[model samples]
Target: MQKNSQEKDEKLLEKRFAELSRTAFQRDIITYTDFLNLNEQNILHTLPKDTLYTRVVSFGGYELAERQMAAFIPDALYLRWGKSSDPLDYTEYPFSAVRIAPLNRKFAEELTHRDYLGAILNLGIERCKTGDILTDREGAVVFLHRDMAGLVMDELTRVRHTSVKAELLSAGLIDYSPEYEEVRGTVASVRLDTLLALGFSSSRSRLTGLIEGGKVYVNGRLITSNGYQPEEGDVISVRGMGKFRYQETGGKTRKNRISVVLRRYV
Candidate 1:
């Protein structure tokens, strides 16, 4: 009797697992908050570890959640809003959500801003912008929610009117120029320890160690001293950290502190 009961329980568990897997495949949006709640309740513990989760957060939101999730699941991906041309214009807030399929490539391109927003609306999730879209590493696209289908269709209709007006305004702004060009700042001098303070992977000793090991270079020459001072015209290149060019150093601030500009090279 005990053996029969155990076998029956296993079968039921397998059936439930299969159902959840199918649902996840069918859905494009999943919230981190919801995922966390389900895990806490022991609903997702048996779910396959092979599942890949992709998260979208506004610039600030990514900073809040990435560390916690990264510690436990390194494979989890986080996408944040990137910088825009207009400095005063702000991107939408409250990061969006999207799911990724394992075999899919060209992620965000597959879905557009309209399609993603439509999905969010369909889910009955309020307080989200209709212009937001989610893309993956490969630029494949997915809508945030499945419910906003009709809203998306309606939005697509008005594009012609909006695009014409936008083009006219862009044409007018093309000839505008500022009164003066902004001066490019330079890096005056950098302490050997500044790289360590800036969160480089190497320690002061390790940095010097690399320098002495002939792995560190400034410009094209290998630097032997970790304490080698970098001047305004010099470029510092660490083996793994990339290269930084020293620009003009704006003299000390009111607190009598040095200000330096380190230009990063791609």
Candidate 2:
């Protein structure tokens, strides 16, 4: 049943991709998609190049964004601009970034990514309109569909018990890298399950269910195999858990186990 549902979703996504390409090609303007998660972005990445009538570009307002918006650029635009113009440097990017911070840092609770996401979703905003939320104890930056930013800023007054402020910023030009804590551990191998267990500090037996349940993704591709080896520098996302990056894979112990280093995003 889950597989069938996924197929239906994929078909719908493929149709959207085709429509966006056709709209851009026929109308001679850029067409954009709502924010898409890693799995959905993977679907976009898998589309055959030959099938697309226009060039596709993706950005989520920052460098390390996990959720992104895709823009379809028509050939007519390229022709009009001449060979010297680059479409990526176009005048407008189709997303907005809002920085949310507490009124009083000393008294505020250290809110998390989940807290921000939950607060936004509770306001009746659809998940597709939101993107990567970079959160720290100081505050968070949330990417949203350009049209929805105003509503969020006006309606979002508090997060947890703290009174907050939300202000939209001039995005796309800004880049952000989230802070993380270094995690060092030893594993028998660089297998997906082993890496996840080490990064999350959880047992492989417990995490296997998450892998098999299709809730884990590595570099935007769904990974189900426990034995799948993630190369160094891979970014992994576990649904409902969080995201982390494999920083180093070296330092073999006397027992022949690999000492791995990971950056677990805070």
Candidate 3:
């Protein structure tokens, strides 16, 4: 059943890819991915190198962060595409930022990523339609498809109890600071459970249940075995939890346990 399902998904993805490629070829415009992770990324990367779209596709998010929602575009088409007569700068990227500032800054509670996403989603926007919602102490800069910029800025008014006014941020107004803290820590093993427990501050037993329940993913593939060992530089996504990276193995401990470093995206 698993094998059959995998094959079916692959076929569906292939169909979608062909459709997008055809659309781009006929329209001569850049296209973007609705949503994609490591598994879909793997499939995309493995696409036949000889295809015309293969060499032209590029991925980016306006800011540097963990597990960014990547886009795929035709290189030539994007070079010519622009907002005005001036060609769009690749560094500027195709994403638009919707800055949400509170009406009363002092009384405004600091919103979480979930809060921001929830509010945007509450506006009837699908999760796949948007990229990442980067929040800071003062406000958040939401990366979204350029086409939806106007709609989000107009429709999104408040988050929770705090009234907010949204505006489309120019490239100069964006604050591209590091969104997460680099948590350097050691783990007893490279097993999914141990690393996840430390990353999430959860107990090993809870992590075990989560992993066995098919809630853990390594490199975008579902992992059910808690004992599954992950190599360095692997992206792990825990549904309803968060995403983290198994950076590397530092060294062995005095107790004969493995030491490792991890990046937990906050």
Which candidate has the top score in lDDT? 2
TM-score of 1: 0.28
Looking at model 3, residue 4 earns an lDDT score of: 100
Higher-ranked by lDDT: 1 or 2: 2
**Which candidate number has the best TM-score?**
2
How accurate locally is residue 81 in candidate 1, as Cα lDDT from 0 to 100? 22
Q: Estimate candidate 3's alpha-carbon lDDT, on a 0 to 1 scale.
A: 0.70
Candidate 2 per-residue lDDT over residues 99-119, each given as its tens digit: 999989989998988889988
List, residue by residue over 141-171, the lDDT tens digit for candidate 1.
Answer: 2222223334433333222122100011111
lDDT of 3 by residue, 159-215 (tens): 998999898877666657554556666677678889998888889998899888767
List of clashing residue pairs for candidate 3:
none
Against the reference, the lDDT scores of all candidates come to 0.37, 0.86, 0.70
CA lDDT for candidate 2: 0.86
| Candidate 1: regions farther than 4 A off | 1-189, 192-203
In candidate 2, stretches whose alpha carbon ends up further than 4 angstroms from where it belongs are 1-3, 48-51, 74-91, 104-110
Error of 1 at 93 (Å): 50
